[model samples]
Target: MTESALLVCPHCNAVNRVPSARLDEGPKCGKCHQLLFDGQPVELTATSFQKHIDKSDIPVMVDFWAPWCGPCKMMAPQFAQAAAQLEPKVRLAKVNTDTEQTLGEKFGIRSIPTLVLFRQGREIARQPGAMNTAEIVRWALSKISR
Candidate 1:
């Protein structure tokens, strides 16, 4: 039997079981019927944060940012590029601190552009600042290897 991983749908918050070997083969959610991985960072809100973060068997990397921050704005495209490069192995997500203040407060986010890596519902590493696409990929890979 092929091993499978539980992945939460980015669009509808439905949990989907994807074969570990077929993660890159485009899995769809049973409940929502939406593509599970889009090779882009999923938008996270206060409502969807817990499920996606806690339920996923794969590592999740979140970018906590505020629209008003210049650094956050500048790094948006870089983050997106990093997401495309990191997907299937890692799930990249974004949480707008301006819209989700509660999440920001819960995470104790004092910076505009903060990246947090979570596995099995617990945070493993956090980087507080804007990073380029290459830097983001390097940082995420380095931390996950540990």
Candidate 2:
């Protein structure tokens, strides 16, 4: 039997069932008709955050950040670049802690630039700090296996 992956659409918050083997074939959301992988991180608010992590078969990497933090600002571009390279396989997302303080509290995020890797709604690994594009990519790739 062929297995399918459940992906939550970053565009319209719709859930899509994609064949595991065809994940890289540029699948479009059934409801929104938008490309699922757009080579950009999804800007997630607290309301939309739970569904993405819980429903997505692929790993979800979240950058917990606030706009006023220097390190978070510095890593924003690098995070975006990493998202461009890692998409379709992994869903990259960002949560502005300043706006989503409840999410920050729920996740126990004490730092401005924290990277959390989640698979099946469970956190697998976490890194707190700013990293360059290469580092971010490498770190995420390494953690996905766990």
What is the C-alpha local distance difference test score of candidate 2? 0.93
Q: Kindly list the per-residue Cα lDDT of model 1 for residues 1-146, writing each as its tens digit.
A: 24999999988899888889999888988987888888789999999999999999989999999889999999999999998898877899999998999999999998879999999899999999999999999999999888
Which candidate wins on lDDT? 2
* Cα misplacement distance, residue 39 of candidate 1 (Å): 1.5
Give all TM-scores, in the order shown.
0.95, 0.96
Error of 2 at 83 (Å): 0.7
In angstroms, the error of model 2 at 60 is: 0.2
How does residue 71 of candidate 2 score in lDDT? 97
- Which regions of candidate 1 deviate over 4 angstroms? none
User: Model 2 clash pairs?
Assistant: none
The positional error of residue 3 in candidate 1, measured at the CA in angstroms, is: 1.4
| Among all candidates shown, the one with the greatest TM-score | 2
